[model samples]
Target: MLTERKHTLILIILLVSLPVFALLHLNSGQIDLGIGTMIDSMFSFNNENMNEVIAREIRIPRMLTALLVGGSLSIGGLLMQTLFRNPLAGPYVLGINSGSSLFVAFTIMTGVTFFQSDLGMIINALIGAFLFGLLILFFAGMVRNQISLLLVGIMLGSFTSAFISILETMSHAEELKVYMLWSLGSLQKVEFHQLGIISLIVFLGLIGALLISKQLNLLVLGEREAKSLGLNIKRIRYLIIGITALLTGVITAFCGPIAFVGLAVPNMVRILFKTQHHIVLITASFLLGAIFVMSVDAILQLLESWMVIPINAITSIIGAPIVVIIVFRRLR
Candidate 1:
């Protein structure tokens, strides 16, 4: 358990580190712009210089995507855990990622650039996640076994991946390259231009999470207790599903299926903060989640001396262990 002072200090540390890491992300990648150069590009627009363009236009968008996706997914994880009353529950665990990935494959392989804009990708991802995510919920009701339900979700993901693979086989090289990169997951795809829509949608999700915080607290007491206290568990569950789908779909559409942060960050925050209050958990999750991901991304930049590791790969490397531990705990 953390002392109140320690909790305050941790929050302060996270708040301080987030901007520091964001700045590091802005300056640390391949081109290696100095902080002065990075700041100048932000304060003074420059169209001519390659360094400025890379600093202001390229890296900033990637940083924003990292921050937004990490934060949104972490909150989504927290929401899923609270709604399902299952510590191991997460957006990716529920087939949302695979569903979004499947539709994205369709868009890339079919050569339909019609809705290829950021808005279009979000729409595609939202539809895909909602369909499969809702299906998982429906199945959860039928299968009383949580582990079996999780297995079913995994099978759903595998089914979607098989479909994605079929699409890949039929796709031309150029199309395959596009689809492949999307599968690998990169912050590089998002430009500053796409930030507006991403920000609006993610902000909406965060707002929804905030509105439900109290209800979530009630839920932590258990469904029967919550119902006795006049809480509508069914309505809250639907709302959480909608919010989780929106956040997961938008982030996956833009950033691909960067995994683990959602599953890991919420657990880490709970361990560190030692509280389930949605007020504390949600805020801490966002701050630490953004910092955790930006730090991973920074490590990826620093590691450019060796190989350009994919964001998803690095995240899985770090998150997989924590997830395994959580599973053991769940089983225990």
Candidate 2:
């Protein structure tokens, strides 16, 4: 009863803060539109006015993108952790993000042009992430030990990084410049339509995660224990990995490879909730992830007055230390 009440309080806090932070996100910037003006512009739907145009077209989409991408990455990390039975596991562990990045780089640099549409980049990213995910799945099947699977994931990440470096070296300065900026990561590039698509994908992936939450909890015990309970461990593991890949692929394709939100948010949720139940942890992680991303984005906007810094840089600075602390604590 106390746990339920605590979770209810956290939910209420998140629900209240979400809009407040979003408003702060809207009001912030060099233009400095007030709350009343922003609200008026939102209702008017007429972009004839400058403030409305900026608010509607620029800030709102970016804010939505941050929420969706942050939520997706956080859930992806949670799924990875459960599947691998490793607290430090993240989307990048299986080379999913690196795979997406490689494909994006190839499209921009080598003129490979796999999917020649507005959504081309997203399609290519999904393909790359899926392929890498399959590779990881196949290798995981071959290996019995968890540590070996982790080593394989690390090796795959290293391979993808090396391939990206080779592509960078061969590309022209203009293409290289574009790829570098994307690699740095930013939320400023999202469009309204893209936000809709990202939101839908993220929502679907999260729902899939929720449906399998019970299986995830079972798997957290041990393979033998899960099997004793009649859980389909193999199928559940594959499903989790695939869903995680889809979530990571879509976010990376649209928002660039965001760092640390995936790694940090799940751990934060686990600690905050003080329970390993996937049902509660997943919901808490999603809300906390959205809040953390928006808060960081708000800070970035404030910092832009002095200079523009990549979102990834800001997140890494904050997230890496948290990761180290978690690792050391776990070791002890």
Candidate 3:
């Protein structure tokens, strides 16, 4: 009963904060819509005379993208932590982000067409991430040692990164410019339709994650223990990896390999909640991740108004120090 009440409180807090953060996001930008105009535009029942088009078309899509991407990355991170039983495990650990990056680089540089459309870029990225994730899963099945699996994943990431470097070196200046910009990451690029697709994919992934929450909780007790408890360890592992791959792939396809959100937010939630339950951890991580990204976006706009700084630059600037502190504290 207490646990249920606690979760209810958390949910209420998240529900309240989400809209406030969203409103802040809407009001923030180069153009000041003001609170009244922003509210009017949001409802679409009023502010018909104001810049309703800009609010609905531009800021709304961007805010939705932030929410979806942030939530997706956080859930992916939670799954990674459970799968690997490592605090540092994240979407990037299995080379999934690298896979997406490689595909995006190929699209930008070689103009490789998957479906003969710009959406081909996202398709190719999903392919790369899925394949890489499968390879990692295969190796994990073969290896009983956690450290070995970690090393293999790191090596795979390095291999994919080397391939991206090769493509970068061979690409023309124009192609390189496009690739570089994509690598920096931005939530502003998603159109309303694209946001719909992303939201759908993320929603499905989160549902899958929720369904496997019991299995994840078991897996946290160790593979042997999980098996002894009648859990299908192999099948559960594969399912988790596959779902995580899909989530990471889709997000990376659009957001350009957002870093550290997956690694940091789960740990932060664990520290705050002081529980290892997948249900609570997953929900908290999602909400916290959304809050974190929205906060970062808000900071980026504030900083951009003061100086021209890329969103990626601001994220790295803020994320790196926090990571370092976490590492230092862990060492002590």
Candidate 4:
């Protein structure tokens, strides 16, 4: 009851802050909009008005993308950690992003223009992320040591990155620039139409993961325990993989491969909440993750005049330290 109450208070705080963050994000770009003006434009405004155009067309989509991407990746990270029983397990850490990058690179290198559409790229990236993710699972079966598995995943990322380098060298200037920009990762590029597709895929994945929360709770207890208690470990593993892949692939496809949002956010939530209950962790992960990414975007807006920062770069720089701290704690 006490833990629930504590989490409930945090949850309420998050519920209230999400919109406040949205409003802040809406007002956070190069040209700032005041709260009164943001409300006026959102509630009642002329269609031809410039503020309305900026608010509706530009800010809203990016804001929504940040929330969706952050929430989706965070939740996906939670599932991956549980499935592998490794504190360091996550979509980015496990080579899911690398897998997606490899396929996305293929699309650019081979000029598979057919898969170049928003939907097509999504499909291509899905295959890549899912395949590499499953490959990690295969390695998980072979190697039980978390450190060994971590090294394997890192090697997988390095291997795919080498392929990407080769592709870039063979490509023309235009293709090289396109791949480079995509690799840099940003939420600003996803338009309203693309946001719609991302929202659908990610939300469905979230729902699917949440529905299996009980199984996740049991799975964390160990495969033998989970099986003794009547949980289908194999089935749950595959389902977790599917949801993680869907969430990671869609976000990577649209926003580029966002590093550390998944790994860092879930670990942060666990530390803050101090519980293994999937029910609490999942909800906390989504809300907290959304706030985390929005906060990063706000910081970027503050530094925009002096620096052109990629969201991925900012995440990696900040997240690496957090992950290292977590590693030390786990070692202890």
Candidate 5:
């Protein structure tokens, strides 16, 4: 009862602070837009007014992208960690992001004009993520040891990286520049028009995750124990991978290869909540993850006048230290 109460209080605080941070985030961009203007733009878009246009077209989509990507990556990390029983597991650890990067690199570097479009990029990314997810699943079936499966995933990522590097060497300067810009990661790429599709996909993926919360709780007990409890381990594995792929793929398609949001956020939630219940973990992960990314982007916005920084760089700078601490704690 005490722990639940504590959790409830923390969640309430997070829920309240989310809007506060969101409002601040909306206002943090280069141009100063008042709260009244931003709210009005949300309800009544005015294209002629530059402030309204910036609020509706630029700031709103960026904030929403941060929220969706942050939450999705956190959930993906949680699912991967639970599925593999590894503290360090994440969405990109299984080479899903690498697969997306490879496909996008090929498409862009090869001068494929049709596939260079936004829609084409999304389709190719989804295809790459789905295929790589299946490949990891195949390897998971073959490997009894979870650590071995992780090794397979790392090797796959390394292989893809090598291929991408080779493609970069042969590509023209313009194409290479485009791919490099994408690999750096950013929340600004999403537009208001694209949010509908992105939101729908994220909503479906979150729902899928919630539906499997029970199975995830069982999986935390171990595969044999879960199977003994009448859980179909194979089916659960498929579901987790499918959802992770869907979330990770779409985020990568839009935001580029963001690092550590997946690996770091769930671990943070686990430490704070101190629970094995997926329902609590998932909800907390979503809220906390959204705040985490939004905070990072807000910092970028504050610093925009002085220096330009990639979103990926900022995340890595913050997430790497957390990862090191996790490693040290595990060693202890």
Candidate 6:
């Protein structure tokens, strides 16, 4: 049990470290711009300056994308784990990303001009994620076993992948190329202009998650207890699903299916904080999640001279070990 002062101190450290890390991330690129110039670019509209342009157009958006994607997925993961009362549950593992991807494939591979636009893709992704979330909830009611539920989720993912494979085969070469690149995942794909809407969506999801923090904490005591406390269990479950879908869908729409942040970060938060308090968990997850992805991306940028690694691959590399450790503990 952490003291309140300790929690406050930890939260303050995380809050302060975010912008500092963002600065470091901005400086990690190939062009060695001074800190002053980079800072200036954020405020000043100096289109003629190449360094400022790079900072404004490329680095800023990528950094912000990593921040938003990391935080959103972590929260989504937290929600899924809480809703299911399972340590391993997450948007990625339970096929929410697969659902979003399947819809994105439909939008991209169909060669519809309107659907290829950012707005079109976001809408489709949200619908797919929401429907899949409901589907997962439905199955949760049917099965008594967590492992069985996880297996069903895996099967759902495989089913979606098979459909995607079919789309890849029948699609035009250009369309196929586009989808392939997107599926590989890249934070650099997001632009400065897109950040506004992305931030807004993430903000809304975060607010929703926070508003239900009390309900989430009650849920930690078990569904029956929560219901006995006059917590509308069904409504809370639906809300969690909706918020999870929104957070997961938007991130997937922009960042592709980032694996394991949703699973790994929230678990890390739980382990580090050792608390079942949703407010603390959510806040820590939001900050730490951003910090985690930003750190990975910064390392990648530093190594960009030698090689480029996909963001998805690196997160999976880091998250997989955590998952294994968790499973081992659960087995014991």
What TM-score would each prediction reach against the true structure? 0.93, 0.91, 0.88, 0.94, 0.92, 0.97
| Total backbone collisions for each predicted model | 0, 0, 0, 0, 0, 0
Per residue, candidate 2 scores C-alpha lDDT tens digits across 16-103 of: 8888887787767777777666677668667678877787778888888888877889999898878777777677656778878888
Global lDDT of each candidate: 0.85, 0.81, 0.78, 0.87, 0.87, 0.91
Model 5: pairs clashing at backbone N, Cα or C within 3 Å: none
- For model 5, the stretches where C-alpha displacement exceeds 4 angstroms are 110-114, 138-151, 169-172
Model 2, stretches more than 4 Å misplaced?
Answer: 40-43, 112-116, 137-152
TM-score of 2: 0.91
Give a tens-digit lDDT track for model 5, residues 1-332: 99999999988988898888888898889888888888889897788999898888889889999999899999988988898887777877678888888888887899988888777887788778878877887887798765577688899899998999999999999999999988888899899889998888888889999999999999999888999999999899889988888888889988899998988999999999999989889888888999999999999999999998888888888887876786677667
Clashing pairs in 6: none
After aligning candidate 1 to the native by TM-score, how far in Å is the CA of 75 from where it should be?
Answer: 0.8
Clashing pairs in 2: none
Q: Rank the candidates by TM-score, best first.
A: 6, 4, 1, 5, 2, 3
| Candidate 1 lDDT by residue in tens digits, 10-73 | 8889889889889888767877688777788888868798888887778888788889988999
Query: Model 4: runs farther than 4 Å from truth?
Result: 35-50
Residue pairs with colliding backbones in model 1 are none
- Pick by lDDT: which candidate is best? 6
Query: Is candidate 4 or 6 superior in TM-score?
Result: 6
lDDT of 5 at 312: 87
lDDT of residue 258 for candidate 1: 82
Best by TM-score: 6
Measured with C-alpha atoms, the lDDT of residue 18 in candidate 2 is 85
Q: What are the C-alpha RMSDs, in order, of all predicted structures?
A: 2.0, 2.3, 3.0, 1.9, 2.1, 1.3
Flag clash pairs in model 4.
none
